[model samples]
Target: MKTKLFFVLIFTTFQLLVNGQGRYYKAQMHCHTTNSDGGYSPVDLVNKYKDKGYEIMFITDHNFLTDSVYVPGVLCIPSEEITFKRHMNGFFLSKNIMPDENFTCQQAIDSVIAQGGLIQLNHYFPGPFTDDNWEVGAPEIISFQNGPHMLEIWNTGTETVQTHDDKSIWDAVLTAGKVVWGSATDDFHPSVSEALEFNKGWNMIWLDTLTKEAVYNALLNGKFYASTGVEITEYQVNDYGTYKSINISSSNANKIKFWGPGHQVLQEVNGSSASFILQSHSYVRIELINEGILGMSNTYAWTQPVFLNNPLHMADNKNDIPYIQLYPNPNYGMATIDIKSRQAGNLKLDILTLEGKFITNVANEYIDKNNYQFLFDISPMPSGFYLLKVEFNDVSKTLIFEKI
Candidate 1:
């Protein structure tokens, strides 16, 4: 009897250890409701996320906040996506304060700060307006430098063209020596797509407890991991600033990645897992590959890298890098390209057929660098799919566009 009791105790302790270490909980941070432009009401949206195994959901409707609702086994936090000329998200805000369009980005920051809420700059790189003429200008670079407590380094449904800009923003912020954290968001808006089951973007925050105040505190303190589809089983930053590692375990992951602005590679044959070493201070990201239908594959996990020391500092762009913007995607006939920089040089814009053949060179010029918009005449080209390649200052981006 003594031996049997001892064996039972050991087994119980082993089970508890397994459960305590490297546990994963899926969640979606940036979601919308009918209070803004979403299809479902706040309650319905919460239920949908919960049913999808999300442990937490932030109801960040445009310029509106919902009351905190506590549900069993899930958390429904009161939050809002403050939609000014630019957008920002404030989570766990006071029940009394409400966001409005009239509030400047700084004012919104101040409001959230007053309530001890956690603030994050949502999609700061490309700026949210989709019109060629709609120039909101980059989030007051100073506010980005000084205001927000955190920034969303990844947003689901964000096009590949804008991803370069996102990288640039993160690099700048990291080099500046700021005290900001990184986040991933779904930016879920039902009107954008007909599929109702597409709630996949979220940040997995590490907290000691499952309470609202505890979670918010953890996020503010930079204790979290963001994910698109993959989940992290273990993440650790050691005493050496030069080394960090992540271990991931998932049900349907084909390939795991440790990619970012560094010279890192995956070590295969390590028990069918992916691993890498950190070299630079840039945001490190992990990607999970998935097979899609119709010759269209999907890369699910889009996580931003966690910096080791002073992850908040912004980098310098002494070259006055030119900013490019494309608008009205899924276009009908013509589309616009907007450029902004401190100086201008030779520019070349090419449209390539989806079949990897050259279609046309739309715009080529030696223009001065300032805010300017140029329209590409696509009426002459056969439609279906094409890529817009823009080259300037030896840096370029190929923007995918659909002609209808």
Candidate 2:
């Protein structure tokens, strides 16, 4: 019997890890049904946003793709809503993207990037029956030059009919270098009442797999976060050597601003949980707020702005770390890892493949640990994305889970 395989084979070059344990998916990318004026009927708006919890629905009906009604557990995604004068919302669609009243919003964003689809800039301020005006901003027309993956920035029907919250045209197109990523919909129209656009604005996707290519690869890699009711269960980011630490939990937020660039706030925390550091920055993003309770006027949550000089991506930030936990997290197979070590001599977890490959060794030796917990079955593995690496002495960590 010869079975000597020590294991530690992480071949390089695929790093874009940002682990904070996975599974978030509560998406609703834009709305409108009856194929246009949207009152309901595309399986009753996917059974009213999957009975209010919404796993993921990108119906986006307006110009085409023709909603082929399919709802069972929900994950729709074939979108289109292109208005030539200015208003767009196309997602991973492969065809049928009609828009041409002499089309020009960069020709409907190059006809939704030539039909492969990914456009989204809906309601860039224009609704008072549209003569177009938001103090004539958004560079006053024809200025999405190229960037286009998102920018609804809260358009619950233009903030419930023209209160307008384009997030200052998404910080004037991210101070004009144009990265584009920020969305919050519920542009729902049943004449706006499923209690005024069910859940108001949403996209909290941090995908593993509910498909539609993992929800457009988590909206093409910005991961995601954009809410209205405020619920960011836990988020952690850390990188030290000069500073950059951010943590957030969220009871319903009391305040947790830390934006950047023109939306500028840098830091402000009042706390259901917040950690804040950031010495210098290029991009930041996090704004929890929550102020409205009895009067109901303020409630937000948005995060997707982390670029302190993005050389591809690395932020799973664990430096001098230990204090890991992973439970339920969409894990139907089994998971319950808890570690709090401070001085454990040897430990090694490893298990990968969220495109990084190498998978095995759930643990190794000598854990005279300072608090540890286990149990990791993953029911015979075989689901979708995964990653978990622990290591001890020189410290290293990661979680990113998902089995169901």
Candidate 3:
């Protein structure tokens, strides 16, 4: 009886650990097909992602959803990438919303929302010179739009451009205290021969089951993480009175990072791999640093930050923390501010317009005991760039914000 009881206890503990670790599955949420502007057909792209061990694929064409394709062992989600002049992609779209080059960016967002589709600001920051030109020409037009469900924080094919622009757009939306998620896509336009390799930009999503409903619902609830190469070993959220702590662990990774607009590196311990304890800062990210010979890195841009408000300050501190970790200059409207230490203490958060007008002030609140987070509120302020100043523990950090 004693021996049997010992075995049972050990087995139960093992099961609990396995359950706590969570599961990771490789998937590709963004791809193209001949149905729109891509070179490959839906069937071919599905085969490609499957061949790459991707359990799921979302074929987002330039303005159309291909007829559903049923394949064994792989899930193909019918979706479209509404290709406006600025380009916004929607996954799990009810129907195709064609892009009109003549329509403004806001109009495009509205159209996608109307279609019962989740909208993502697709590669809006950097792309060809034409894209950059479009953004500059319509800075106000683009900045005026506020709420979006998600943003393509990274695209493997456009890594160079994505790295810079994603941060910019994320910071902008975060500063506004909006609930926005981040996603990664292959955005592949593969040739017939390359169809097998088309899903190289696949992101691994962690879900409870392998069903279309489960995957889509997980994404909507921000239950998954995105990745190109590295896989997440563990992720969870721990809520404290004044701050939320996000703990993440990865496998075969050289570095793990938590980056967004207002990024504050809480704890970075380097080893065969690394471990970090990030103070919740209103962003979703799980990155694995590549220690490969070529120094190439694999990143996982997962769900957005889930905000847990402190009931004591819910009314006064209603704004979610801003994404305050990007550049340019003279932010007049909203901005991100990073706080580095985790020790809980009185923190004074302030924002001022570039022209020297005081915008907001929140005083004497406890921060994370180990890590700090960014804070911004600009709902009442007028348009223009501004400066963000955070005062805590006799230390001051400031950043720039632009208002449109």
Backbone clashes in candidate 1 total 18
Compared with the true structure, all predictions reach lDDT values of 0.56, 0.65, 0.52
Task: For residues 343-389, write the lDDT of model 3, one tens digit per residue.
Answer: 44556655566565666664447655332333344445566555556
Give all TM-scores, in the order shown: 0.59, 0.31, 0.62
- Candidate 2 lands at a TM-score of 0.31
Whole-model lDDT, candidate 3? 0.52
How do the residues 226-254 of candidate 1 rate in per-residue lDDT, one tens digit apiece?
Answer: 66555555444433446655544545556
Best-fitting candidate, scored by lDDT: 2
Encode model 2's per-residue lDDT on 125-162: one tens digit a residue: 54553336223355633254444667777777656642
lDDT of 1: 0.56
Rank the candidate models, highest TM-score first. 3, 1, 2
